[model samples]
Target: MAKAFASQGDLAEKKVSFTEVGRDLWAFTAEGDPNTGVIIGDDSVMVVDAQATPRLAGKVIENIRTVTDKPIKHVVLSHYHAVRVLGASAYGASEIVMSEKARSMVAERGQEDWDSEFGRFPRLFQGHESIPGLTWPTLTFNDRLTLYLGKRRVDLMFLGRAHTAGDIVAHVPDENVMFTGDIVEYHSACYCGDGHFTDWPATLEAIRCFDLAAIAPGRGDALVGEKLVNEALDNTADFVRSTYRPVARVAQGGGSLKEAWDACRTVCDPKFSNYAIYEHCLPFNVARAYDESLGIDTPRIWTAERDLQMWEALQG
Candidate 1:
């Protein structure tokens, strides 16, 4: 291979930050690693997006203890990705919640994604053996589900698809703060391997329509205040559009996948070269963009073997 595959070379631990985005709402961010949201209510607590493994999730629990000793009654999965859902058991929450489509994706491609991601990013899955099989939601909802942690209200809604087919967001109406799971990244690369390019912008617009005061994004720092939130939204939309347009143009014109990759790099690198995980996400993003342009609506399942095959073809 031309370079270390994905984030295998990134072994150094990142500086973890627990920032309060809104009243009693905390965001656990580790540089550009996947983030977890903590919503403390009048009684119990609700967690969003469990980390990659039990050991990693323990860190979030430790942070949670610093603030309030309230029990974590619910764990909400933003999507069905292994990195986001495998650490669910660590929470020990009575109710594990996910959108119906997300649970279906788990039934469809969960293990394959687990194998693929564990191989791609070893740093994220520090305690892989502790994952205790695939994480399944005890509770599933179709479009929207409202849960109350005492007086605090959390609205978990499926606001179209962007990063994945079953992507969802947790909105706290009282705080005007949203915990957007991979849907809105802040200065971080969007993992579009399972994404829908055409549907991404519209999904982003739907979040924008809310005019949120704060957002705990899937990765990077927590976005507090309306201006920072809007910036992240605009930048994320730009990243998705920029990656897709050039690759789509190349593919529609009968260009090779390599050609499409080069075209996407030309457009995306200058603008997003400094973004977190930019390199790790590029080839897959380009390949998916090519496939989407060729009229593939659903993203192809990524297995460990397929990841290597695609990486060798693009990076070798």
Candidate 2:
């Protein structure tokens, strides 16, 4: 490989921020790292997107403790990414939730994703040894499922495929706040290696239709108020579209993967170079865009070996 993954060199710990995005709802963000959402109902708490390891999850739990003593009874996984679901056990929630498609993906490529992510971003999986295994959901719903944390209705809906085939969003009806797992992002780059580029914009529009007041996104800081929420949504859509267009144009021209990479950079760099994880996500995003442009509907599973091979090929 010409160079290690961008995440491999990111060893410095990020400053953690636990901000209240809505009444009784909190967002645990670590600079640009993966974020966790907390929804406190009358009797219990529901968490969204568990961290990558049990140790990292402990931080979210610690923050949750500061505000509410209610037990975390439900842990909702937005998708099957190892970075988001592997830390589920740490929550000790009796009901671990995921969309039905997400659970199926776990059955198909969970281990490969675990190995691939661990190899690419060692810093995120600091306590890998503590992860019991591939995290599986104890509960799942196909389109939508409603859960009440003692009268606080929480709706989990599969809006559409964006970040992954099974991406879902948690909406708190009372507050009109949504915990959008990777379906929406703030300033951070979207990790689209397993994404659906063609379907992504529509998914964003679906979320937009909700006109959410606040959003605890998959990554980046919590977006509060309608203005901020809209800004994030628009920016995310722009990011997704910006990334795909150039790469698709290159691939449609029968260009090499390296050529597609360069093409994507030419367009995305000037606009998104300062975004968090921009460098880390660019290659994978370009590769997926290239594949999708060629009419590949399903994203090929990324394994550790494939990550290295793709990196080397792009470097060439």
Candidate 3:
């Protein structure tokens, strides 16, 4: 029998943790679930990556209130994904920020993506009705947007295309801390549904310039200290390469999609099987890798229908 599509069957709630990674920086990580980075400036706060729904964002907000009552002045989106941006309303942030490219993507398919992801991860979208339509960025920049939290500075940079074309990282120069969206995952599976396999490695190389002391990735536990941070970076890079290389080879060899998925699984599952969302992300990741290997540079939009079709094809 075919399994449930995407994470719809993943009903188990994860335990949430609000850990202080730096002076005023906090990582709200829920086991292997999606994470939120909080940066408390002198006056206000900046939230990186809102949760999937208003209800979920409320939980993050409650955590934020525990440490500081500062208004969430800015909500920065690392990339344009329904699971990440739909919670903007909950923060009531003055400025919702993201890359211009991400804004374009939101304009292009934000509705479809919202529908697609909500269906895929029903657990994440518990209060689906509370979402007040699609989230729009009030402020968008091309490459970098520097936010001044009094004397401190948080530079939002678009290193290159990896997880998505508009993927960006928030770097705290003074602390040498980074809030890397999905560009760097720890134990969690890197969702490559919209990933750029070729450009990702180069993007990973750029992250080393920060000489990070700590990193809050999109998922998994926060990486503390230089060594662990680098290791997580390397692991994320490996996951990307391992998922792509085999699928690319199979596609170039004119292998079937099932064969390509099998090749990807043989490599990824051995190392990443126990990781969070490995099963849910595998089919979509493999499908995108297969397309990219066939010289398709642009990632096709993922709709609920396409998601199911691909899942059935690969799961069979």
Among the numbered candidates, top lDDT falls to 1
When 1 and 3 are scored with lDDT, the better candidate is: 1
lDDT of 2 by residue, 251-300 (tens): 99988888889888888899898988888888889889999999999999
lDDT measured at residue 225 in model 1 versus the true structure, 0 to 100 = 88
Please give, for residues 109-211, the per-residue lDDT of candidate 1 as tens digits: 9999999999988999987888899999999998999999999999999999899988999999998999999999988999999999999999999999999
Q: How well does candidate 2 score on lDDT at residue 143?
A: 98
TM-score of each: 0.99, 0.98, 0.98
Report the number of clashing residue pairs per model.
0, 0, 0
Off by over 4 Å in 1: none
lDDT, candidate 3, residue 122?
Answer: 89
Estimate the TM-score for candidate 1: 0.99
Error of 1 at 236 (Å): 0.3
